[model samples]
Target: MTSGLDARIRLSRGPVELEVALTAEAGEIIGILGPNGGGKTTTILALAGVLPLEDGHVAVAGGEWEHAGARRLAPEQRSVGLMLADPLLFPHLTALDNVAYGPRSRGSHRTTARERARTELASVGLTEHLGSRPRQLSSGQAARVALARALATDPDLLLLDEPLAALDPETRARTRSDLAARLAPYEGVTVLVTHDPLDALTLADRLVFIEDGRVTQVGTPTEVLREPRTPYVATVVGLNLYAAQSDSSGTLTLVGGARLVTADSTAGSVWATVSPHSVVLHRERPEGSARNAWPMRVSDVTLQGQSARVSLTGPLDLIAEVTLASVASLTVHVGTDLWASVKATEVFTYPR
Candidate 1:
C-alpha cells in the first residue's frame, strides 16, 4: 500500500512539548487516544500546517509539506481537511452554501461547486436539510454538514478532532455511524483524536497513545487491548495494572510492599495485569488453592452495565468487578471488610 501521510515532528511551545512520528497508508484511519493535555490536538494541528514543527518533516500523498528547518507550507497550501469539535459553520450561509464554500474557494466554477456540494451533502444524509442555516439545524445535522464541507475539496488527508464530542449520547451514536460510512469510500489518510474508547476502537484501523507530549504506545486496537503499556491505557481498557519488581522465583513485589505470586517468573522491574473479573471477593478469609489472597476493605463501588466495580484497599489496592447478584449476596459496601483472591494463572507479568 502507498503511504498517504508520513510525519516525524518535534514542537516546543511554552509548557507543551511534543515529539511524534506517525504514518498511515491510503484509506487508513489512525486514532490518537490519550488524556487531556496529552498533545493529541497539537499533533493534528501540525499535520494540518496550522502549527509549525520545530524540526522534522510532514508529507502527504508523497508531497512534502514541511522538511528540515527550511521548507514549510502554509496551512492553505496543504491538501488537508479539518473538522473540529465545534462545527464552526458560517452562521449567515445555508447548509448548501457552506458545503459548497470549500470547492468554490479552490477556484471551481460556481455551478460545479454547488453540484459537488449537493453530492457531498447527499452522501452524509443531509440532502433534506440543504437549505437550513446553522442555527436552524440540530447538532447532529450540523456535524454532518461540517463533514460534508471537509470532504468537498477532495482533500488528500482528513483530521478530525473530537468530531462527536458536542452531541448527546443518542445523537453521538447516530453521527458516529454517519461519519464512519462517509469515511469508508474516502481514499485518504484520516487522523481522529478522541478520548472515547468506543470511538477509537470502532472507527480506527490502528491506535496511538500519547502521554506527556510523547508517543507512549502504538498498535492495532486488538493488540492494545491485549497488552497496554501504560496506566492510562490500562484504565481506558478496563484492566487492573500494577507496577512491581519481580524476582526469578515468581514473587512480584508492588510499590506498597505487597507481594503476589505469579505462575510466570521474570527478573527486574515488571508490570502485572489482571482482569477485575478475575478477582474473587469473600466476606472473610476462605480456604482456597489460590496463590494470592488478601484481606481488604471496600473503598468504593461503581456500577458498570450489569456489573459493579468494587475498589478495595488493604494489602494491595485493586479493583474487582462482580455481578449485581454477587454484590447483594456479599453485602458489598464502602468500609465493609472483605477478602480478595486471584489464582496465579490469572496474573500476567511482563517486563516494564
Candidate 2:
C-alpha cells in the first residue's frame, strides 16, 4: 500500500490551466515555489480540498482524498492541517484555547483537546504564552501559536502557505529557524507553498517550481541551485543564465550571436550560468587572461548591503555584483561605460 502523498493536481481557472504532479514520502517537506498567479497556492488549496479538482487525484497515506468526477473529501473531512500568512486567531480566546480549537472541532473531548494543545504549544516554544491572547502576543509569538494550532490535531498532512511571510525580516529569520526545528520531528508529510528561495532551499527535501500554471522544474535544493531550467528560476537562484549551443571545444553560442567560453566541453544544446560575483568590471578594457570580456554600459545600479548589483547592457546583458569599495573606486553608475570580464572557469554548463 502507498503510505505517502501521491497527487496529480489539475484545475483550470480563467486562462490558467494548472496540471502538476506532486509526490513525497512520509515526513518529507515539499516546497512549492513560483511567481504570483503561477498556481502555487492553487495547488495547496486543492491538496487541502478547498478547491475541487477538474481532473487528477489527491491521495495521501494510501487513501484517496480526491478523484475527479469520482470521489472527493470535503476540507473538514480530510486529516489535513492548513496554516496561512495570517494567524487569524480569535480575539477572545487565549493561546491555549486557540490551539485547542482544532482538536475540539474534530470532536475530541474538551479536557483531552486542551491537554493535547498544551503539548503542541510547548513543542513550539509557546508554553509560557499559553494564557496570552492574540493581541497580547508579539508577531513572532503569534506565528508560533498559529503553527501550534495547525499541528494540534496530529494531521496526516500539513499545508503551510507563506507561513512566515507576515513577519519582519528579523522576526522572519528567527521564526524560520523555529519552524525548521518544529518540523524536524513531524512524521506527517508537509507541503510548503512559498515564494522565498531561502525557505525552499533550507526547509524542503525537494522543490517543485510551478510557473504559468505548469511545473517547470523539480529537484533537490542543490540540484536546482546548480542548474535552473527557466529564466524565472535563474532569477530566483540569482544567476545570469543563458540558453546556448556549445561546441565540443567549450565555445558557447548564445541565441543573440554573442559567445562565452566555458571550462566545460559539453557539446550541443546546454544551459550556461555565471554568478554575478564572478563578473569583474573595469573602467578600461581589461588586460588579462579572461576569455570573456566585453565593453558594456551600466544600465542600473542597486545597493544591497555591502555590495551593489550593476546591470550592464551590451552584446549580452548581464548583472555584476561587486563590493561597495570596488563600486566607489570604479565610479560605477548608470550610463557609465565599463569593461566586464568573466573567467572561462566561472561559466558553468549543463544539459538543456
Candidate 3:
C-alpha cells in the first residue's frame, strides 16, 4: 500500500444515481458538501463498504479496497473509522470503556486498550470525563468521546458524516475548533461530509461539491469562494447567483428579462454573481454613481445574527444583507417598496 487515496465511486439507490471521483493524499482532509439527498452520504457509504459500488473502485494508500464486482472489503475488514451526527455512544458504558472497546475488540490487551483510550480521551480534552457515562455528558462532550473512539483503532482513513450537525450553534462552533485541533495531529486521511460552509471552509484542505449525483465543482476554499460554479454552491457561499448572457461590452441580460452591467469583458453565456453585502437599499430613487439601480419591493426580512437579509423582488429577485442599524433606519419590512443599487464593479461574471 502506498501513502494516499484514490477512489472512483458509482452506485444507484432508488431514483438517485451516484457517480463521483474522489482523491486525497495521506493526512489530507477532503470536505464533501452538497444538498440533502444529493448522494453525499451515498459516496461515503460506498467508501466505508456499507454500500457496494455498482462500478468504479476504492483505493487508499496504494491498497485496492474495492474494485466493483472483482473485489469487496467488508466494513469491519477494512481499516476505516466512521463518526456520524449522532454520537451513538453506549448508554450503559462509561466514556473510557466506550472508547476502549474499539482497541479491545481489535485484539489489544485490556490494560493496553484502557491506556490507549485514556490517551485518546485526554487528547480530546475529556480526561476528567473518562468515567462519565453518555447520559451524563453534554452533547459536545459526547461528540468528543465518539471522535476519540473512532480514532482509538488507528485507522488509516477517517470518515466523518456531519459530525457536528447535532450540536447547537455555540457548541458547534467551539466543538469545531476542538475537532480541528484534534485532527491536526492525526496522520491519516480524513473525509468530512458536511452541509455547513464554516466546517467545510475551516477544516478541509480541499472541497468537492456533489449535486444530483454529479460533482459540480472542486477547489481549495479560497478558489471556491472566489468562483462558485453552481447555484447551490453560490447559496452555500452566501452569494446571489444568476445565469445570464453577456454582450461584448460587458452588459448581461438575465433569463428573467433583467439586465446587469459588469466590469468583466467575458462575452456569450456567463454566470453573474453579486454579494448580498454589496447591495444598497434606499427609500426613493436617489442613487448616484452606481450603474445599476431598480425599484424593488421587500418580500421578506429575516434577521440573522447582527445583520438582516432582505429579499427584494423587482426586475431581479435578490437578497440584500444589511446591518440591524440599517434595517432600523430603512424600517425594512414585508411589502415595503425600496430601490436597490449596486456598483458595476461589484458584479462579477465568469464563463458558464
Candidate 4:
C-alpha cells in the first residue's frame, strides 16, 4: 500500500540557511524543479535522512522519524529508497548482482534476495540484460537496472535525484518513458528532483518552484503555468507580468493610469499581462477588431536569437515580439512612432 509524508525542515551551514514545509501522498510524484544551487537536492537529502535537520520533523507511513524536542531515528531505520544521479554499479558485479546487493546487506538470505532482485529487474524490463556488467550494458539499460536496484528495498518513500541527467537526449527520453510506466505501479510517496521542465510537466502530479532556499510557488501543472506569484515564477511560467491597480466596470489602469479593459472580473489591485506576440504595431492608431491601442515610440529593438523583441515608450511601456521578417518589413527603428494594439481578451487579468 502507498503512504503519506509530512515534513518541516531547517538546514544550515556557515552563513546559509533553509526552512521549508512540505506534504505529499503515496502514488503521487511531487516534482521539485529549479535552477542550480536552489537547495532542492538538499531538501531531498534531508527528507531521505542523509542530511541532518537543525530543527523540525519528518513523518512517513504513520511512522515518525523526528520531532522538535526529543525523538529521532537514524537513517537506516527509515524504509526509504534513494537513488542518486550516478548508478554507481560495482564494476566487478553483474547487473543482477548489483541489484541484489542492497537486500542482501539488509539480512535477506542470498537466495531470497536474488529472487527479489530478479522480480524487480523483470518489472523494469532489465531481466534480459541481467548478466551484462555495468560497462557492458547501454546507458539506458544501466539506468533501468539502477532504478530496479532502488526498488528492490520495497521502500515507503522514493527519492530520485536527476536520475536521467547522465544519459544522451534520446536515451534520456526513452528511459524517462520507462520510468513513468514503472512508477505507475508503485503505491508509495515519491519525490523527483530535476531541472528539466519537460520531465516535471510530464511525470509529476504537482510542481514546486523553489529558489534561494525557499518555495516560491507550488501547484498543478496548469495552475503553475497560469498564475505565478513571483518574478522568478513568472519567468518560469514564460510570462512577462506587472503589478497594477484597477477600478470597477471591467476597466483597468496601468502604472500611469493608462486605461484598458479586462476579461477577468476583479477590482482594486490587479496584475496585467500581455504576451509579446499578442501585440500588433502600426504606424498610427487604426480602428477596428483590437480593443486596446496605445500611442508608442520605439525605444529599443533587440533580436532574441531568431525572433526579435522591441521595447516601446507609450501610454504604458510595452514589449512586442516579432519575427525577423516582420522587423524588416515594418521598417522598425529606434524613435519611430507606432501604435501598439492588444485585445482585451488576450490581456490576462488576475488579482495581485
Model 2 stretches with alpha carbons more than 4 Å out: none
TM-score on alpha carbons, each prediction = 0.93, 0.98, 0.97, 0.82
Model 2 TM-score, 2 decimals:
0.98
lDDT-wise, the better of 1 and 2 is 2
Q: Residue pairs in steric clash, candidate 4?
A: none
Q: What is the C-alpha lDDT profile of model 1 across 115-200, one tens digit per residue? A: 99999999998889989999999999999999999999999999999999999999999999999999999999999999999999
In candidate 3, position 351 carries an lDDT of: 84
Q: Candidate 3 on 129-220: residue-level lDDT in tens? A: 99999999999999999999999999989999999999999999999999999999888899999999999999999999999999999999
- List runs of model 4 lying over 4 Å from the truth: 249-261, 275-288, 291-341
Per-candidate clashes come to 0, 0, 1, 0
Candidate 2 local lDDT, 1-352, one digit each (tens): 3588999999987767999999999999999999988998889889999899999999998899999999999999999988899999989999999999999999999999999999999998988999999999999999999999999998999999999999999999999999999999999999999988998899999999999999999999999999999988998889999999999999999989999999999999999999999999999999988999999999999999999999999999899999999999999988999999999999999999
- Per-residue lDDT, model 4, residue 240, is 57
Candidate 4 C-alpha lDDT tens digits along 167-261: 99999999999999999999888899987777888899998877878887899988877877776666565565767777776688776778887
Candidate 1, overall lDDT? 0.92
lDDT of each: 0.92, 0.94, 0.94, 0.84
- State in Å the error of residue 287, model 1: 3.1
CA lDDT of 321 in candidate 3?
Answer: 97
